[model samples]
Target: MSDTGRDSSVSSPEALRSSPPVPGMFTMVLHTHLPWLAHHGRWPVGEEWLYQSWATSYLPLMRAFNTLAAEGRENLVTLGMTPVVTAQLDDPYCLTGMHHWLANWELRAREATTRTSGEDTGFAAPEAMRAFGIREREDAARALDDFAVGWRHGGSPLLRRLVDAGTIELLGGPLAHPFQPLLNPRLREFALREGLADANARFAHTPGGIWAPECAYAPGMEHDYAAAGVTHFMVDGPSLHGDTALGRPVTDSGVTAFGRDLQVSYRVWSPKSGYPGHAAYRDFHTYDHVTGLKPARVTGRNVPSQEKAPYDAERADHAVDVHVADFVDVVRRRLISESERIGRPAHVVAAFDTELFGHWWHEGPLWLERVLRALPAAGIRVGTLTDAITDGFVGDAVDLPPGSWGSGKDWQVWSGEQVADLVALNAEVVDTALATVDKALDQAASTGSWAPRDTVADQILRETLLTVSSDWPFMVSKDTAAEYARYRAHLHAHATREIAGALASGRREHAQRLADGWNHADGLFGALDARRLPR
Candidate 1:
């Protein structure tokens, strides 16, 4: 999912399982993802991205989901966590790093309390700053406590608990969150297999579905889904030609493509005016540099950061109230309207990035909690993507055009002119990885003895996979962090070339040494088998 901006387990909703699928069924799908950030840069962009989302979004979202489950809400939402992000979430290194990050957060908040007054400091008033600091410190402490109880051993355990309890219908995905349409058939198959296997390995439960990266799709990709035993995936509304009343079976396959109802989704993410942009909500961008806290409301779109009004909890609360009511109304009205328009009951999916909640829109989780509650009260039925399909929401098949939920609802964002060089770089990397690994396996076969573990080949595949993540081109094209994106693409590509070259030169010792060094950073997918890279 895209932020355009931007959970623990509990009981399965067995209690709510019998609620008949009603018309106007709504599924709120959240795709939780971030590239592998460990050992990468920090500060402006890097591992901090993980920490910020973990503390602000993940923890709060988990609270919301758990609270709902505790209240007996099941089929709450369909969630997709890409394997790349899950790897970091489960890493011991990242768990330790996040603990320290939360500690620093509280320290920063406490330090901000020492300031005496605001005066004309271009920051909030001294009293306001002190209060903000105190509140932040408490938040940090609670977050730290949450981490200790649930995340001490890394996220897999918590996630597994949720899965086993039937709290969520986890979506299967590829290992690195690669944009599958662009990958070669073999690599695409490999990525999907590895991703699903990773899910099974981590949670011991294999998901039948996935939130396709970027909701990106192309014709016949459904075959790959079926081959990998993927039963369902998400696509954009336009991919289904705006008839998102139900999930469509793609091209005679059992794999279902659930189109995100943009009518419902864009309500929160609209570029022009979405709920998050409301003036009364806390602003996402403005900040108090010394305190590392956001103390301003979005007083106005054009308002200078310093001139923005101080964040008033009451004001933000009211905005949340209004927006929650408005969103509920929107979903209810859309469902009623679409059901009427289609002359039948309809299914609507409003999907987004999980970070958009606490990380981008501070009140998002509360707003979400309220909306989910209000929807059922208003007689609007809710279910997961699976529920919709099982409840007979499947519709006519669609020959999905090539598209993504990104900018143009097309592939340009990942393959446009600006990043042509990187695209070529990816092709080079993939082709070389296949050939090198294929050759090594062929030689091993001919010698009548299997190669001793092919560490070099494994590293080559790892670097190659990292090099082609859809994120790099996306960042470069969006100019959000273009330089960092370029540097990373080159970094992984360089690693792959050097190691592959060493292996090709019969210098097994040299290749093994290079692979060892790269493992410190890109080491992931321990079960990865270069032999899986078939012709």
Candidate 2:
């Protein structure tokens, strides 16, 4: 069935009868994830994604959250920060790198004001480029100032503040954001347990919900969720076959699966059509390469990069107003129609990547703030995914289809023929690492309540976990930084094999040295213990 199938078999009349007399519930879920990017590589592909998304997406998104939060807005957006990404945001090296990256952004913006144009940059008019430069320089300075004041401690403190303030409902996911369905069952559970534990270490509470790593789901995965104490998680609309009037309890488990309301979501995110592609919005692709700043407007869809018009802030603001109003109307209509059709006020979730806000779509933060503010006034009740469940927008059990939010709504992107080697690598490394770690735990066993921490085994497990991250296969299949993705996977796998070998061979000194080296390079999740790896 298509995403808009509207099949009603999933929800019976009895479930909808008790729903409250509200128009509807709406939630904007931001799945904030960037693969573990610390010490792997730098520009063009690696940690650069982390820093750019930090500056453009995270910082501005936080600003919006803080501003709305100050106004006493609660349950605004359910934000998911993957444990791997959160680790980097809290990592010391990453903090320092971000500080420098912010400074460089400022310098680059200032440079745009004075630099001469080459053949590539010649498309940028002098005055227009200077205006863009001046604006960017000011924004960069403000970002740097925000970083100095609010982010100096790292992402944990910032996220903790949001959590404490009760402005956002946080969602946690597995460490490294692995595709859980394809993972070894023991390793899968281990990663998720540690991932939520990692969340507790920072946020002081394990999130009741998760983003489910690409919204990927398998038949029995809900059992794992129930075991993990998760109340809810997200999947794409098609997974529920568009009978998403309410959250569905998966297989009689208490865990609820909220399907994305694609009708409302695609209004802003669709490739064929969306607000960001509007002509007045700043063009995301065309750039003034001289200073690495984009100075063009998306004049038309088919327009060439050089031929695109110069960006106008006022024009973009006007376009945002128009789009915001359009979205509010869309939500209003969807709520009314769905409620009437389903015999109750329905639940709608529009989940998107958090990075799309400021990093990919330059004017996205402004649009987000405007639309969020406009929703309640337009008579729509907006809340987090948990709030939707609490509001009684829930239905009968669903034997959810195996699916993902990726291309074709299947696992092929992460487990396909083109990446067959990577799939094999993941299976091999997990088996070897698990067997080796189990043996090491036996060697390091203790009579006390706590098993002594095994740095060597922990390092081996760490590398093994990193090697199986979904990002490598996704990148390889998508051809976006395919080389770097493959390299990272192999690098971690190699580290895992070498360390596991040294420890298994009883070369204690050699294993310790290898553990020390890899830990410095990939020392995320400081709380990881070898004893925790066994099923």
Candidate 3:
């Protein structure tokens, strides 16, 4: 059965009620993240990442989720929010700023609605008013209100509500979205564990599944995930050799791993031909030359942003319906085909950055709303990783090789030329930090003191974390905001160098200054639990 394979006899809600329970299961995973942005940088690119995403993606998606739940429907989606993103969402400063942004957004929508109303006064074509109706303006107002409520609560409450309502399964990831395979083994373990700890503290639920940053995977990571109480994680399709079967626990480890389904995933978004490139979707690359904002259509090739017409919600909604219907159809067909081929139902995992829905693809939330509702109606059940595991449908085990869902689904993002310098610096910092930790442990054991070189230990720990931040390379590669990345890399490198110099020269004051600087930054992992670091 294709995603569109709803029985002709089961066309209505009443008909669906009589239909057999949708046996085909589909899982949607949304990974949400942005590096530490508080007091970090802004504008041209920084905290704006938070505000823009909040306005475009988080707010709308939360609204959609809540809307479904309000209808007494169970929304089965998986959300993977990194700790850094969570921190900013909950930060006092960000909450205040987000509230302001929501107000501004509401005003913008109001202004657009007013402008459209005025422009309609002299309208001649029946299609003109057909295009601009009271319902459309009301929808805009509803979208604004929904966004304001979600943003006002700062997302934490919305997240808690969703989890409590069983609308979605929450997945945890690294504290700051670091690519674990390239990081030091111990740091990798610490990052994953500390991330889980942070999520557990905030959400009041210890996540058993993690969205490994970039979907980057390595053989030994299972050990770390197991240690952190994570029972399963995701990787790219190639990582598990295109096996769409339910995930299999690694040998002798409690952790299970599932590979992404490229077939179904590419339908919604891909390097090319994804829904984002649709002629009707919002244009991401080109901004209005005068306003310095995105206010244009993704008019097909040859049509420039400056020439593109004002956004038309109806056109975009039609596109959303088509794409979402296509997505549901694809999943249904895959489920039926795989079931027949493998003699068992196969799980189709569609995973993507949470930002893609509303940020990159402006109509994404709308599409999500339709697609999620359409899945079950079409005889495909929505599920979480936990549901998949508990149902006993898991298939044969295969070695999941190292891979990430980045460009080429490989390690290029974390280890490419743009990030090579930071990688080298991280290597040096890791070595020195590890040696310092070992010495501290030795000294503490001998002296029976918990306060051996607190200043030095703190600096080393701070430098270690700063060096391992995943921001540098990501910025460099995307060229989205390279200057900030450079500044941050140097900031950490300088701190690490200063701490090392002070440690060498026995200059306690210099070391103290570096530790104080780090303390002020107040990065969540700066004071990582030393016990969590591997021996």
Candidate 4:
């Protein structure tokens, strides 16, 4: 039966046995991703984004999960970390930088603490250091220490510990967050399979589901999703034609597509009027032009930083409480209303990028903490995607159309603006890299000399990864860091052209120059395994 027909029949509990006794359950999926940035660049563009995000988002959020799990809240959330991001997190260079960044963060906190303690009468008084605030700061410090220690001990091992301990439900994604709909079919398949394998090998867990980059989907992609052992994935609400279903496995393939119910999604963060825009939250767009950090309020026009009051911890806490209350109430209402209307408990799945919390929305981590704690108290039980699917409440197979969670819910974002040039460059690099790899393999077979192939293979692998990074197009489209995008695109393009030229002519001098340029540019993916290339 078609998805609509099946859902219609199952509208009432009497119509289908799949509907549960309640209205519906809800699960939250959060995506954690960033480009390969370690040792590439910093400050205005690259590694800074990774480090700041790790400081504000990853560490605090992971600490939240650890704390909740300690309180017996296992599997409170389902989180997907793309393999490329994971690889960087596990990289030695990244670990070293993080240790330095963590130390810097500690110094900042110590300074803040000292500054506050020295104050006498104002809001920043010495007595302002209350137990909760102290505990929060100390907890943040411990979280940073734990994270640094975890990385030293091995990021993959620490991640495995988190997963095995039930602190989180691990999720996967495509190789490099490709816009799969526009990619060549063979490349798309290879990207997905290799991505899944890489995730499995490093994390020690093979994901049964994935978060398609930008939630991009196309008809027949389901077959690939299923082939990669991805049992479920996310899609925008409109993409699913208003069918707010959870765990609905596709008919054409074994995979299921879960549509994000906009009702709940909009409550947390939306294009406008979301919780993130609340005056209490830290403003993301307008950073202090001097310090390169946020030191302003989202005040009404004409209000200067000096006039804006300090970050009112009380006001922020109150806003978090209200948002959490609203969320829990909404979830309960949806569950009750959907159950009454459909005659069985319906499931509501809300998904979002993990960066939204602390990186983009400064109070996001606090909001998440309150929301998780509030839901159960409000009688709205939370669930993870895997839990919902394994419990057997999913819709029948339905062929999904080509779509993405981009501008117009399509692939336009990656292909729009100056991004078009980057896209073309990416295509050229991929083609050249593949050709170079093939030629190198053939050379090794004929000359019985593996050294030449092995040496040139490094640049090929580097170009392949550079071509795959989603950042080039994303930065261009966002226009926040356009120059960086252009530089990366040109750098990758140069690498591709150089590799192809040297491989074609067997010119040792030219090849060495190209290798040196790649190294001098400090491209992070230069050290990747060439065997990852498709045969």
Regions of candidate 3 where Cα sits further than 4 Å from its true position = 1-23, 106-153, 289-293, 441-459, 522-527
Score candidate 4 by TM-score against the native.
Answer: 0.84
> Which segments of model 1 are wrong by more than 4 Å?
1-22, 118-121, 449-452
Each candidate's number of clashing pairs is 3, 0, 4, 10
Name the 10 consecutive residues with the lowest summed lDDT in model 3: 1-10
Tell me how far the alpha carbon of residue 232 in candidate 1 is from the true structure, in angstroms, after superposition: 0.8
Which model scores highest in lDDT? 2
Provide the overall lDDT of each model, using Cα atoms, as 2-decimal numbers: 0.83, 0.86, 0.73, 0.70
Q: What number of backbone clashes does candidate 3 have, counting pairs of residues 3 or more apart or in separate chains?
A: 4
What order do candidates take by lDDT, descending? 2, 1, 3, 4
Per-residue lDDT of model 1, residues 334-394, tens digit only: 8878899988899989989988989999999898888787678667788888888888988
Tens-digit lDDT string for candidate 4 (91-210) = 777777887877765554454444444443222234433322353357557867787565575467766777888877888886667777766665677677777877778877898888
The TM-score of predicted model 2 comes to 0.94
Clashing pairs in 4: 11-342, 13-343, 22-345, 23-345, 23-346, 24-346, 249-256, 250-397, 251-397, 251-398
In candidate 1, clashing pairs total 3
What is the alpha-carbon lDDT of model 3 when measured against the actual structure?
0.73
Candidate 2: give the clashing pairs: none
List model 3 lDDT by residue over 451-519, tens digit each. 344655655765667667776787787785777887887777777777766765667687768777776
